[model samples]
Target chain A: MVSITEGKPLEHTLEQLSTTREVTILSCNTCAHYCGTGGRLAMDHLAFHLNNNGVTVVGKELVTKVCIQEQLRGCNHTKTIVLMACSSGLISAKEAWPDAVIVPTNSTLGIGSYDPDTGSATLLFPFPGHETSRGARFPSLNTEAIR
Target chain B: MIMTLRRLDYHALIAFLPRDARVLVWSCNTCARLCNGFGGKEATKALCSMLAEDGLEIVGGEVLSVSCFKSVIRKRLDRADLRMMAEKATHLIPLTCRTGVEMMRNELPWLEIVEVGETVGLGYLSESRGAVLTNSIVEMLDLPDEGIPLSEVAEDLGLFLGPFER
Candidate 1:
């Protein structure tokens, strides 16, 4: 289990990257993948949505572990990075390319365990202010639409 | 870092196992290790010795870098030698966070896993103060701006700190 995160509503994410051009989607395939927020599928869905909305997606980089600085080395420095990872991975991306604008698509809820048997991740340990969300089980984010 | 506190003491832990239990100890060597030797190679070795001295059948003890990851733990347990030892064991003592324990349960469904650690929350290592829990999931705890020290949390909650002491 890793950092448990939730995807922000697609509208919110789009609004955050509204003015940016030549956007690069940086997705974490580990924790965010398990959370159903920032994997290959999530990145592609977001990219498709952004493209249809007239936002140009220049490139897409899928990292196995985005929290590690070395994983971000291969990502090209773009004008705007639509990062589909947790807060930690976002920080790593920021540190990797300080000049580029980083836009996060998810909120780091806290740390939790993913039960493959149940196919849902339980929020066992939420972050400081998110204490009320303990023991909450989250299913995969709906990707049928950009809403 | 993932902060954890001891769920049971040595005596309580011993009571959980039967008299003829063939125990296998599996520990996580990452976050739990950084949480002041709660679970690591050193703790695994110490627990094995202690359990052996107490007359338990210590089939084997192993420590993985990150027990939470399926690939890392599956590879270790799939090894011929470890598999043989695991087959002989009836119970497993997991010295890891809840996620790691879930991974163990998924991997080894036959063996009964005796959980002995409770995951408190996420924390970071401080230069001056050691492991300080910045964010806690324990709703009862009211944290300060700088967060509370893990040692204080452990003591306040009537939980044991570090490795299990006999």
Candidate 2:
């Protein structure tokens, strides 16, 4: 039900997650897939982009539904998990695999064209929403912020 | 996972059904499952029920974990009950993406494979608003709102009890 538009540079995302070791990208094939942010086709393109950027993408997984606890259990032994899904999917992955370092691939510009800098929940078309820190918030992401 | 699915209209879907044609439903829990477009176990059951009510013979039905995966669908067809039913089934109605319909067709070359859901595009699901179809795919497919956009077919059937998991 949540909608997000993001256009963060792929170069930055690659530099953050693709470190010395292999990086595993968990592309949500469900919600985010529908949203065109992450899906099999998008993940494949991302992997292609990352590989071209000198990042070693060990694997790209199309998690059927990253929000589901059961599907979240498929995390690999790889150290990093790059998420292409929304915040809800990230939370589900965190709960399911507490040890894996998670990083979001996109920086949400906001629902529709609204900037996150102004704090207000936008409800359009009865879409379900996820609670997030508003006001141009950046998801805590760093190449060294691995857990 | 959430898939953006639209149902097929029943009137157009069954127009070519021959007399005494035995139908077996097959749906994928992949893209079709993501969208409420009649792509899961519940959809298959509901389709079978609707066909039965319409005086059609439904031999059997199953929700394949990945109907688009040719090998998996072949394995499903290899099941004793499914194989037996498929032997007698004259047609296969797949409530799945275009890939799924083709895979089913390849798997069973003799049976007539029917598509009940148009693979519009990849999509998202909101707990509050249900299925949301993105624009990229809509533009890619060049779909119009009228003239048998498959989901409307299932909507016309009006027997689905859904939002079930893949």
DockQ of each: 0.17, 0.05
Compared to the true structure, candidate 2 yields what TM-score? 0.52
Residue B140: error of model 1 in Å?
4.9
**TM-score of candidate 1 on Cα atoms, chains taken together:** 0.65
Model 2, position A87, has a per-residue lDDT of 53
Question: Candidate 1 chain B: worst 10 consecutive residues by lDDT?
Answer: B122-131
CAPRI-style grade of the A/B interface in model 2: incorrect
Q: What C-alpha lDDT, on a 0 to 100 scale, does residue A132 get in candidate 1? A: 91
Q: How accurate is candidate 1 locally (lDDT)?
A: 0.80
Which parts of model 1 are misplaced by more than 4 Å? A68-75, A91-100, A117-119, A124-138, A144-147, B1-22, B29-57, B63-91, B102-116, B123-134, B140-166
DockQ of 2: 0.05
Name the lDDT value of residue B90 in candidate 2.
94
Q: Give me the displacement of residue A87 in model 1, in angstroms.
A: 3.6
